[model samples]
Target chain A: MNDVLIAVMMIVLTIITYKGATLVYQRFRRMYTAPIILSTVAIIIFLLVCHFSYETYMVGGKWIDHLLGPAVVALAYPLYQYRDILKKMVLPVLTGTFVGAVVGISSGLLLSKWTGFSELIIYSIVPKSVTTPVAMSIAESSGGVMSLAAVFVMIAGIGGVLIHPAVMRVARLQGQIGRGVGMGSASHAIGTATAMERDHLEGSVSTIAMVLSAVIVSILAPGLTLLLL
Target chain B: MSKAVTIILQIIGLYLIYLLGTAIQHTFNLFIPGSVIGLILLFLLLSLKLVSERWITEGAGFMITHLPFFFIPATVGVMGYAYVFKGKGILLIFIGLLSTGLVMGISGSVAQRLAGRREKAHE
Candidate 1:
C-alpha cells in the first residue's frame, strides 16, 4: 500500500471505529462499551487480524497522537474555569488525592514485590495511577520500560473505571465531589471521561484531581521507587 | 469571524503554548513533559487574566471532549506485549484493580468526610 493511502486508511479507520464505539456506548451506556476501551479493543483486533504492525498503523495514528499534547494543554482551560469551586473544595480534594497518590504508588510497589514480578514491572506500575504521558516519564526516570509503563497506566485507567461503581457503593461515598476525586485520582483521564459523561461539574472537579494527582505522582514516585521498590 | 476560523485560531493559540512549553522543558532539562508545562502555563495565564477564556474556550472544549479518543492508540499497544504479560497477566490485572480500588475508596471517603464536615460546620 502507498504511504498516502495507508495514512488515510489508518486515520479513517480510527475515526470510524471510535464513532461506532460511541454509538454503542450511547445505546448500552456500559463501562465496557465506552469508546476508549471498546474502540481500542476493536482496532487492536482489527490490526492483529490484518497483521498490520503498530508502526504501520502509526503512519496515520501518529497524527492523532500528536494532538495529545494540545489536549493536555487544553486541560488548563477547565482548571481555570473551575478555580473557584476548586478553591472551595481544596482541602478535601487536595488531601484526598495526596493520600491517594501515595497509596497508589506504595500499594503497587508492595504487591508487585510480593508477587515476584520483575523490578522493571515494579517500576512501570509505580506511577500507574497518573495519566499516560506523565506516567511514562515517571517510569522512564525510574529505569522502567516506558512502553510497559504505558501499558500499566492503561490497565489502571480501565480497571479503575470498571470497578468504580462497586467501589463507590461499598465505600458508601455520598457527595459528587468525593466521587469525582476518587475517579480522577485513581483512574486519571479515563475516569475523568466517565465522570464527565455523568455530570459536568463533577467531571470538572475530576479533571483537577486528575491533573493534581499527576503532579503529585510525578513528584513522589521517584522517591518512593528508590526507597521501597 | 466564522466558527471555523475561531476554532482554528484557538487551536493555533494552543499549539503555540504547547511549543513554548516543550522549548522550556528542553532548556531546563526537566523531567516533566512539554504538554504538562503548557497546561500549567496556560492555567497561570488564565488565572491572571493574561489569556482570556474566550480565546481558548472553543478549542479547549473540542480537545477536552475528544480527549479519551486520543488515548486509544497508545492503549492498543498492549497487544504487542503478550510476552511481558504471559503468565502474570492475571497478577498485573489484580494489582491494577486492587490498587485502583484502594485509591478510589480512600480518596472518595476522605473527600466525602471532609466536605460533609465543612457543610455541617457552616450550618
Candidate 2:
C-alpha cells in the first residue's frame, strides 16, 4: 500500500473508531465504552484480524502521536478559562495533587514490593498515575521499562473510570473539585475525560489535577526511586 | 479574525510554545516533557496578558474535546509488550486497581475537607 494511502487510512480509521466509541459511551454512559479504551480495543482487533504489523500501523500512528504534544499544550485553554477558579482554589488544588501523587506512588510501590515484584517493575509502576508521556519518561529514566509504564498508566486510567463511581458514592464525594481532583490524580487523561462528561467545572479541575500530578511525579520520581530502591 | 485564520494562528502559537519548551529542556536537561513545559509557558503567557485567550480558545477547545483520539495510537502500541504481561497480568491489575482506589479515596476526602474548611472560613 502507498504511504499516503496508509497514513490517510490510519487517521480515518482512528477518528471513526473514536467517534463510534464516544457515541456508545454517551448513549450507555458505561466505563467500558470510554473512547480511549474502546478505540484501542477496536483498533487492536482490526489489526489482528487483518494481520497488520504494529510497525505498519504506526507508520500513520506516529502522525497521530505527534498531535499529542500540541493537544497537551492546548490544555492551557482550560487552565486559562478557569484561571479565576484555579486562583481561588490554588492551595487546595496543590495540596490535593501533591498528596495524591505521594499516596499513588507509595501505594503502588508498597503493593508491588509486597507481591515480590522486581525493582524494575516497581519503578515502572511508580509513575502510573500520571499521563503516559510523563510516565514513560520517568519510567525510562528510573531504569524501568517504558512499555510497562504505559500499560500501567492505561490500567490506572481504566480502573479509575470503573472504580470512581463506587468510591464517590461510598465516600460521599460531592462537589466538582473534589471528584475531579480525585479522578485526575488517580487516573490521568481518561479520568479527566470521564469527569468532563459530568460537568465543565469538574473537567477543568480534573485537568489541573492531572497536569499538576504529572509535574510533581516527574520531579519527585527519580529521587524517590533512589531513596526507596 | 476568520475562524480558519484563528485556528491556524492558534496552532502556530502552540507549536511555538512547544519549540520554546524543547529548547529549554535541551539546555537545562530538565526531566520534564517539552509539551508540559509548553503548557506551563502558555499558561504564563495567558495569565500575564502577553497572549489573549481569544486567539486560542476555539482551536484549543476542539483539541481538548477530542483529546482521547490523540492517545489511541500510543495505547494501541501496548501490543508491543504483550509477552512481558503473560505471567504478571493478575498482579499488575491488582496493583492498578488497588492504588487507583487508594489515591482517589485519599485525595477526594482531603480536598473536600480542605475546600469545606476554606468556605467556612470565608463565610
Candidate 3:
C-alpha cells in the first residue's frame, strides 16, 4: 500500500537523520552540532517542502509512540543493575531531585509573573523542567498551552545538548552517576541521549535520573502550584 | 517458564504494575503519569525485595533498550504548533534551550559535589 511505503520511508528518513546528526556531533565535539537540533532542522525542511501535514506524519510516527510506555517500564533494569550505588545514594538522589524540580518550576512561575506574563503562559512555562510527555499532560490538564509546553520541552533538550559538556568540564564531574543524574534531571530525554554518547554508564545513570526527575516534578508540581496560588 | 506462560506473566505483570501505579498515585496524589508511577513502584518493589527482578526482567529489559526510539512520535507532534511559534519561535525556542542548559550545568555540578560528599560519608 502507498501508506505503508510512506511509513517505511518515514522510519528510514528518521534513521538517516539520526545517524547524520550523531556523526556531526561526534566529528565536532566542541563545536556542538547536536543531532536533535540538526535532525529537527531537516524535518522542518522536509515537511515544508513536501507540504505534508503534521497529522500525516503522525500516522507513521505513532508507531514509535506506542513504544514509549514499554521503554519507560524497561528503565527498571539499569536502576536494578546499579542497585547498590542507588541504595547508597537514595537520600541524596531524592534530595537533589526535589530541590531541582521545585527550584526549576517555582522559579519559572515567579519569573514569568514578575515579567507580567499571562496566566496561560505562566502555566505553560511552569512545568518546563518535567519530561515532555508529562509536561504536555500537565499543561493540558491545567488548560495551558500544550503545544507551547512541548516546544519548551524541546528547548530544554537542546539546551541539555549544548551546555552539558561545558558544564561537566567546568565542574570536573567525571563520575557516571553524577553526570548522568544531572543530565537526566535537567534535560530529560535529550540529556540522557547526550550522556549515552559520552559513555554507556553515564547514559544509564542519566536515564534513572531523568525518570526520577519526572516523577518528583510530577508529584510536586500540582501541590506546589496549589500552595503558592 | 514456558513461552506461553512467560507471555501470560508479562500481561499479568503489566496489569499489576498499572494497578500498583494507580494506588500510589491516589495515595500520594501524585500528578505524574500512571505508567511512570508504575516504573517507580516497580523500582521500589524490586529494591525492597517485594518483587523478583527475574519475573519482570524480560519485559522491562526490552522496554529500556528501545526507550530512545519512543521520542520520535512526540517530537513529530511539534508540527501542530508551528503556527503559534511562527513570529516569536526563535526567541521562545532559544529561551527554553538556554534555561535547560543553565539548569543542567548548575545541577550537574551540584549533584556531583553532593554525591562526592555522600561517598565520603559512607566510608
Candidate 4:
C-alpha cells in the first residue's frame, strides 16, 4: 500500500479501535477496561497480527502523537478552575511535589546504578515519573533514547494507577489532597484521569502535582543523574 | 455562535498558544519544552484575566478529559522494542514499577499529614 493511503487507513483504524475500546470501558465500568489500556492493547495486538511495521503505524500515529502537545497545554484549564483550592492548600502540594520529585529521581538513579545499567538507560529511567513529553525531552537532552524514556513514563504512570488503592491503604494516605498529590506527582496524566473519575478534588490536585513535578523533575533529573551516575 | 464553532475556535486558540511557546523557546534557547511553557502561559493568561475562561473552557475540557487518547500511539510503540522485554530491560522496568509505588506512597503520606494538620488548625 502507498504510504499516505496506508496512513489514512491506519489512522481510521486506530480511531475506530479507540472508540470501540471506550465503549467497552463504559460498558464494563472497570479500571482495567480503561479506554487507553484497552485501545492500546487492541491496537498493538492488531498490528502484531497483521505484521505491520511500527514505522508504518507511525505515519498516521504521529498525527495523534502530535496532539499531545496541545493536550498538555490544555492542562491549564483545570489549574485555572481550581485555583482557589490550590491557593488554600498550597503548602502540602508544594512540599509533597518537591519531596516526590527528589524521591522519584534518587530512587531510580540508585536502583539503575546498583543494577549496573548504562549511562543512557540511567538517564531514561530517571525521568520516568514525569509527564510524557517533558520526560521525553529530558531524556533526549540528557543522552537517553526518547522513545525508551516515553515507555518508562508509561510504566510509571500505569503502574502507579494500578497500585493506587493498595499504596494508599499501605501508606495510610487519606484525604483528597494526599491522594491527588501521590498520583499527580508520581503518575502524571494517567493517574490524574483515574483520580478524577473517583473525585474531582483529587483529580485537580493531581493535575497540580503533575505540572509541578514535570517542572521539578525536568530541572532536577539530568543534573541529579549526571552527578550520581 | 454554534457549539462546534466555539469548540473549534478554542482549540485553535490553544494551538496558537502552543506555537507561541515553541517560538519563545526557540528564540531564547530555553530548556523547557514548548508544550509545558504553553501550559504555564495559558494558566497565567487565565489568572491575569488576559484570557477569559469561556474562550478555553470547552476545547480544553474536551482535550483534558480525553488526555490519554493521545498516549496510545506512544504506548503502542513499546511492542516494537523487543530489546526492552528481555534480560535487563525487564529488570529495569520492574524497578520502575517498584519505584512508582514508592513515590506515590511516600508522597501521599507526607501530604496526608500536612493537609490534615492544616484543617485541624483551622478547626
Compute each candidate's TM-score over C-alphas.
0.93, 0.91, 0.78, 0.91
A59-176: candidate 4 lDDT, tens digit per residue: 9999888887787788888878878877888889888988999999999889988988888888888899887778988989889988889889988887787777788899887788
Off by over 4 Å in 2: A222-229, B1-5, B117-123
| iRMSD, all candidates | 1.6, 1.7, 2.9, 1.7
In angstroms, how far off is A146's CA in candidate 4?
A: 3.4
Query: What is the Å distance of residue A40 in model 4 from its true position?
Result: 1.2
Residue lDDT tens for model 1, B1-123: 988788878988998999999999999987677887898899999988999898898998887777778777777778887777667667888988899999999988888788886534422
Clash tally for model 3: 0
lDDT of 4 by residue, B56-99 (tens): 98898888767778778877877777688697678887889889
Instruction: Return whichever of 1 and 3 wins on DockQ.
Output: 1
C-alpha lDDT of candidate 3 relative to the true structure: 0.68
The TM-score each candidate achieves on chain A is: 0.93, 0.91, 0.86, 0.87
Which pairs of residues have clashing backbones in candidate 1? Answer: none
- Candidates' C-alpha lDDT: 0.85, 0.84, 0.68, 0.84
TM-score of 1: 0.93
**Model 3: share of real contacts kept:** 0.48
lDDT of 1 by residue, A1-229 (tens): 9998998999999999999998998999887888888988999999999999998999988888887778778878877876776688888889999999999999999999999988888998899999887898888888889988888888888888788888999998667788989999999878887787777667777887888898899999889878996
The TM-score that candidate 4 achieves is: 0.91
Standalone chain B TM-score for every prediction: 0.85, 0.84, 0.74, 0.87
Worst 10 residues of 2 chain B by lDDT: B114-123
Model 3 agreement with the true structure over A69-126: per-residue lDDT tens digits: 5455556656667777667776655666666677667766666566556778767876
Which structure among the candidates has the greatest DockQ? 1
- When summed lDDT is taken over every stretch of 10 residues in candidate 4 chain B, the lowest stretch is B114-123
Ranking by lDDT: 1, 4, 2, 3
Native RMSD of candidate 3 (Å): 4.5
